[model samples]
Target: MRILDRNIIKYKFSFLLSCLLLLSGEAFSEQQRVSLRWKPSQGAESYLIELSEDRDFLRVHHFYKTKNFRYEFNSQDSKFYVRVVGINADGGRGVSSPIISLADKFAAAPKVKVERPSTVVASSEELRISLGDPKTSGPSSNTPGSPNSQKQVPVSTYYRVNGGEWQRYDGSISLSQEGWNEVEFYSEDILGNKETPKKTKYLKDTTAPQVRLIGEKKGQSGLIEIKSGAELTLQVTEEGSGMEEITINLAARDGSGAEVNLTLSGEEAKQPIKISSSGIDGLSILRWEANDKAGNYIQSELPLLIDAKHPLCVFAPTEGKLREDGIYYLKENGLIAIRCEDPGTGSGLSKLEYKIGNGSIQSYQNPIGFNTGIHTVTVYTSDRVGNKAELKIKVNAIKPDWQKTGSELQEK
Candidate 1:
């Protein structure tokens, strides 16, 4: 009986030891894989992952699953109970945490960075620059095999002109104007990482041609006395590029009352234009116009009066008809007279040229004789000032025969 009791006790002890070993084996098998994964929920909605130690949820490990289903947990903790909750598109929560232990999960999230350009200048000609993806920083992605694994990110740059409108500039554009121009650059990574802030730079230019008229202002008017064969002078200066050429025009009122053109030859800035008036007559006004290499223009009018006067005919009489006998009697009478005067310069009438109705012009000294017949006599006279006068006359040539008879009767 004693032997039997000892055997039963040993058997019980063995069974108890076996049950403890089984429990130990199950505990050892529960060692977590250190990785994590999950089957996406219905409708491809994202799932929220959480980790905690006590079932009461003292500390929660939160993770967002996008298109990816696997995540690696890097925490050194040996044992951690994980749970997943369904997340809706509207940020609404559907289910509370359903416990899942890391004992069987696989995978973890990798580190990501971004890249960008070193220096952004106002004169840079790049249209789009790639900031790195969520991997490397600073233009490293422009190289091959970089963390910026994807194609370059499209970048847009804008500029302000003197604090004015924001103008977009493409890659390969160059700055033309010089001023306090400001440029701002923007870039976005493939991973949706936008440049934290825009970059800016200022440009300055202190070089440009200085232009001025050396002798006169634009639209200046004054007497311009140039020798008959001398050149007219115009002084123009440009500090940087210097003056190119000059132009002058003899502007005058034409016969049709329009501004007529007369171009002067050999006109250059800072140079003289030799002009002569010996053969030129009746020029009313002269003017100078100038231009520079930059296409800027300056103009001045020369108020020059040229002396060119000529003799002019001023007067001639208009009336009178007489009988043939009266014309005959005037021809018989010696004294022939008519009133005459000079209008211009009012000088006395000098030598005269007389003609009667298609007759030859006859030169006469002062007094002239006329016949009796009805005569249409015309005379042209001149004064000392080269002005001319004209006169026409009808003279009575016949005397009454009754006057002769009455004298004869008185003698009888």
Candidate 2:
């Protein structure tokens, strides 16, 4: 019976010792670890950890974790509970703290606000817009983790002119004309937060085209002469807007202002105005009036001197002896050089007028071919500037070896 009692006491003592060891192991394990850990769910990798006085969602303690969390809590304060939730990532995940105490505190979530562009002006040429802070009316502070913050949101602008199509503007866009217009702008942040639509209206177009003349003055006389049976010329030009047409009205006037009108036509053409008469010879005034399609005009006048006269040539012999031989022959080919000038002061010789003996009146510049004989030569000259001269010559062609046949022949 004594052995049985001793064995029973040993067994009881062994059981109590095993219980103490198990309890101590559990206490040490609890001291070493304070929180739970798990792989974050999809879209919930980055999380915000919140501490509360209790799990009832009543009095919030602090923002425990603000960045991506591999949660582990080591705190030594009044016992508190925490819950963690992801903001942007996708997941049905939530973690809560088994009430604990911690020495360090967590920061709270930052407050968020938005800023917009001020006085955006829209035009057909350009859109001028500026951004300012909502609080200070200056550049918005974009510091990380700040409450009043903004991202340089990629914005696309669109424009509609008087209910026209909305053209998208990637950066800056220009307006086309001067008037009121509506503009709509869209902006989105990296976090998928979108701004409300912005709109405005403004004026545009502040320029004009330059213009000038390419040719001479209006109504100016061209470098052309006017005479009976002659053609007149006129030149006109316009620098800008191009030359479309030129109309010219030409007229012939007598001393009494009685004029006959003629029409000339061309679209930038070098036109020739014609004049003719029915044998009445007198001074006439030729006038030309010109105008461009742009309603510009100019007038000019030229004095037309007219005369009707036939040319005549006179012949004169130089100081040379005539041969006594009935067949006159001299040492050299003697010439009856003729000088002809126009007799009419207002008309010109159309060509050099000449005649040899009783031959037909023709035109010649140099002397005509002459044989050893008594020949008569005449020439006439005339100018359009009202000038004339005439000359004639008699040539006694003789052989170099001939002498006077008789004194009567020489005297004659």
lDDT of 1 at 287: 60
Winner by TM-score:
2
Clashes of each: 37, 44
Model 2, 287-370: lDDT tens digits are 555432222234566555444444556443353444554322333655444455445434545567778788888877654556
Give the whole-model CA lDDT for all candidates, comma-separated.
0.38, 0.39
- Cα lDDT of candidate 2 equals 0.39
lDDT of 1 by residue, 239-348 (tens): 42234345555533242222334343223444534344443322345666543322233456655433222233322112223445544234333555444543322323
Backbone clashes in candidate 2 total 44
